[model samples]
Target: MTSPPQPAAGPVSPLNSPLEPESNRKLAMLLLAIVLYIGVLLLPTPAGLTPAGQVALGLLVLVVTLWISECVSPANSAVILTGAAVLGLMGKSLTPGARPMKSADALAAMLGGFSSTAVLLVAAALFLAVALKHTGLDRRVALLVMSRVGISPARLTLGAMIVGLVLALFIPSATARVGAVIPIMIGITAALGLPINSSLGATLMIVTAQACSIFNMGFKTGAAQNLISLDFMQKAFGRTVTWSEWFLTALPFTASMSVVLFLASLFLLRPQVPPAAEAEAKLRAQLAELGPLSGAEKRLIAVAVLLLVMWSTEGVLHPFDTTTTTQIGIALLLMPRIGVMHWSQAEKLVPWGTVVLFAASISLGTLLSKTGAAGWLAQQTLGQIGLSALPVVMVVGALSLFSIVLHLGFASATGLASTLIPIFIAFAQTLPVTKETAFGIVMIQSFVVSFGFILPTNAPQNMLCYATGAIRTKEFAKIGLVVTVAGLLLIMLLSATVWPMMGVL
Candidate 1:
């Protein structure tokens, strides 16, 4: 009656992984970056741009190549790109007819992102994720609700979507949210006696991962990249996007996509879940075992609701920006006796590399703008496309489709935003619209940066769920294509309608 031994797992496909940056590939990418850097420097500096701008453009290409290929660690690449900027271009002034740049002055612009509000918000958001993980409140919330959805295949799929939507508000880190939700989903799949790769299992996991991504567009704090985009916008235009405004700006689109994600998950993936009659009790029991929310859960929930309020009312009920409010909340969570967790425990759980990457992304994009490289590059590329001649709606569609295609090359949306948002900010400026509307155009494109649908490696959340071994790359890509198409169209539609009405188009 004993079962035979399971087969040894083979090598993981790169399509389903974050594609670790190591070996010959890493060296090759670095060499390519060098070739690109040298080539750009050798070319005649384009008209309307400074010699410093050309150097910055070369750095942009080289750094982007490293980031997308992930040939070097993000933090390392960030530092490398900035150092190269200061070292190579300190004598060249970015502004025509200005004093030649000094080392400290050039260095200051390169590191500007590290001091911005968006970077601090990103750090605080990670702390929020850590607190949830420390208290297991994230798991409890996910399981408690999902356990209630009947074991029907479609219902289970919808439950996953609902969990992702709810968690988007509570957990700012999409990767952390998926990490907490996917295993619970896999467990539910297992208790039903289904194989991990069952249509139902794969469908559930796919939707679980995509849901986390889809909702990242909804909240300003939902994704680290959103903060990065806001930082770029702030630096470029001196505008601030509040939590509630971001929510309202995004709600119609995110809401529509959420439904599209569900239909696509249910019908496209076609999860043929069987009636696992008994597993329902196992699901409920899992939630029950937590034994009536402990003291930590109580404190975490109370603080979370309050933080949610604080985040939502910024610029309306309070002048405290998202970063200030978030730091205040994190402070409460780290207090000795009254808090849910300690700095020692919370720090251990936080991904400090994210902070590095966030700061670096901001710095890279800021430097690109400061040196006029982003605008120059945009003029050479997007500018040639005659986007200004097209209606504002077409601008949305064009930039969105471009972002999706560019995302194929990127592993992190933060990197994508760094590489493109500045270019986008510049590109938007050329569009025949008011300055405010042009800023809105850049904000809209940032949402597309979150579209990590086509491949697992494209987003951290997608990769985390893919690691469960329940879904194949092709299956994930199948759904991603549908969502990508749908998301792009929705963005365009909103650009013409909702966004315009809000004066955001």
Candidate 2:
């Protein structure tokens, strides 16, 4: 006999199901992190930490968790973190025998990120990128470079990487560089009649992303984290790392790694359709169609050249820092009819989320350093590693590797640096090395933190390319693993040889 029919199934309950909307899941995560924060705060203070430090640690734990989970937008998380810090400081002021931080000091600690030179520089750089895009200069540069490289896919890849390197020198923001380049590369792909998800398209996208990340290490202003690292160096070690010094120290390693990345992409991620004679014809046609640069492009070039000169000579000719010089460039760009673009146009291109995220990260990092939270955390974690018993080079390598592994949980390079740099500073002191050597080790660790290419969420550059649908996760992972391993080995080599020769060791 046939079995009786089952009753019709009812709608699934949200309380018992995992299939909630993404927004709902994110909200749950945010609430869970808040609860964790409260639990940590209410628990007894751990040894070797002040009450204020304990509070700061709790906030840091919550923020890091939220960031890693991406339970909220980074900007929103930053705002929440800043508010929590202010409240935590206020609570400390009310505690008996606590060293009460003044309200002004607390405000500064919570909101000072907005006033950072790095943040301002990034803002100005956004405007500059907009100017380049608005005047068609970015596209013109891309076509010019591609036209000269011929129609071979490998040659085009090299040309794109070279353009990325050149842009890194002047642009100073990896996201902006990717923003400027991806569209041009996409145009090239379309001109060649290649599908967006074709192997060639994927290769070009990955190359652009990888090149942006690799070259970020070559220049001090290439990434926001580089500036954060320098700030930490000056504050914690009484040492200043000028742009020229950073370029001198990091260029050797970055240039070599970039070559490895290019070769790896060429060999491992070879395109499905190699560039043909028609591809060259298409590029030339595109160039011929655009004809010559406009008056706007000419003015932008002058302004960009002036900005580059000022940045390269920051500590030498003018004594104006990178931020000051950028401000000057922005002023010229926005000045009357002579300006390349109006404020309205430039403002539209600015990535405001990045601005808020970096500012809050800097503020949080400053608090972590000032309140001794970073030091205590470092001592508790690395202190147990018995680093003193290991060779100095070995210790540096371990720390560098740890920084790379840690990036799996961090979406923002600035967040990773802000969290780890202070701890590395403390970890350096525990090593059997000179103060200068320790400083150098910390700087090296800072550089490795930028190697967040293994996952799409690791860096914005990766995420942007991933959005193109040209690359599959496994495809990216395959290349990312090779590059990451190569990068780690290179860092180890530098720590053993180049760093010592440079007196960083």
Candidate 3:
């Protein structure tokens, strides 16, 4: 759903350079990963770090290096990690001394990630995204929201963000939401005869992308990474965080950031010239051409609303969890009477690779936690730096800063979560705090996993929006860095006050 290339709003020469060939780069990165893995393996196992833990740490380094360098696709790289774990972690014991893990047992433990309901939930989300696209419901919703706004720059920018917030609920995949909603944004810029290269045009696209990231934390199903974080949190803390509960916790941060994002576009990245007075008319006209909702749209709406009710009422009106309810919702859509879309239709749009990658990532994180590698590594790093000795707010601040800087090297937040979340979960555990406070630390940091706010390459949706040629990497960074800092301060606020009040911090 990417718009065709539009006129670039800013200079690009600053970001371009000659680079090595792709195959050569892959070979170089793979070699670097192998070196790091062997380096870890050769390191004398520190006290309390068993042989198995050391091997797990080695595998973590190898896979992360590969992922960061794009040496291999994340799914295949995960497959490598799994195969390695099956062989590498079949040890005599998990602790200093214990019962031996049989080869079959090692294989089973390594594959637990694929068996997790989170994988199925992600697959279910893809199916739902496909069904929405098949019915064109997502695009209609976006346009309907856009149709309601006046043509002022402030109104148009706010309209784009509202579209993102609303679509984030209905369209679970961030890229899919951008695909459905942003072409309309581009069309509006085009219709206004505004070169996307202009300040107004570029900011419009950037905010559309940023808004997707903002609300990715707002809803449990907003992004795949959110589920990744949730999976880690539940495993570490052994408690469920229901859909409504997550919404209530995230509302203050997401809502405040939404307002900040709007203001930034208006004052910080002001358009060179105001859009034509006819912009709203064109938006409504495009929405009008879609005409009345189709039969499929109506049925899809009903199913969506029913699912929303079920999701909101979980633990209150019913015992069904999010994964179960989502599966039920998709099943209804595929059924004969409901008939939102055929399995064949969804099959075409559904991203099976994402499901594979997500499952594999979980396996990687699971290996880290189960083998005690994460805890030992946390002891080595966070403990070494005395982060645990800092004040509670300072601990959060330092962690947030670390997460932001680390995010510069990561392209996929899901990959970042799979790598760092387990360690942080262990970091929380090792903190000299109550079991509840430790759990709270993990919960609060999970929100930081959505911090793909500093680079165009940081997220799939950012890359998708960047393809429009409306925003240069440098220009995007200007807005992204500001949002990243603002988001960090907001998290600090929540951690200091609201999250603690809610027993989350």
C-alpha lDDT of all candidate models, in order: 0.86, 0.82, 0.83
lDDT of 1 by residue, 139-258 (tens): 888888888788888789888988888888977788889988988898888888889899988998899888888899999989988988988888778888899999999999899999
| Residues 27-84 of candidate 3: C-alpha lDDT, one tens digit per residue | 8888888888889888998897888888888888888787788888867787777777
Candidate 1 vs candidate 2: which has greater TM-score?
1
Runs in model 1 deviating more than 4 A are 1-22
Candidate 3, poorest ten consecutive residues by summed lDDT: 11-20
TM-scores of the models, in the given order? 0.93, 0.91, 0.92
Q: How many backbone clashes does candidate 1 have?
A: 0
Clashing residue pairs found in predicted model 3: 8-197, 9-197
Give the Cα-based TM-score of candidate 1 against the true structure: 0.93
Highest lDDT model number: 1
Per-residue lDDT of model 2, residues 1-505, tens digit only: 9999998999777766765677697988899889888888898988767777777788888898888889888789888887777777764642336568766656777788788777887777767777877887777788889889876678878888987877787676687788878877887787778888888899898889888888888888788888878777777788777777788899878888888888888899887655477777888898898988788888888998888788777788888887888899889888887788888878877778878888888777777777778878888888887877888788888898889899988888888988889888877876778999989888888789888778888898899999988889888888888999998888888888887998878
Per-residue error (Å), model 1, residue 440: 1.9
The full ranking of all candidates by lDDT, starting with the best, is 1, 3, 2
In model 3, which regions exceed 4 Å deviation? 1-20, 90-103, 272-277
| RMSD to true structure for each model, in Å | 5.6, 4.7, 7.0
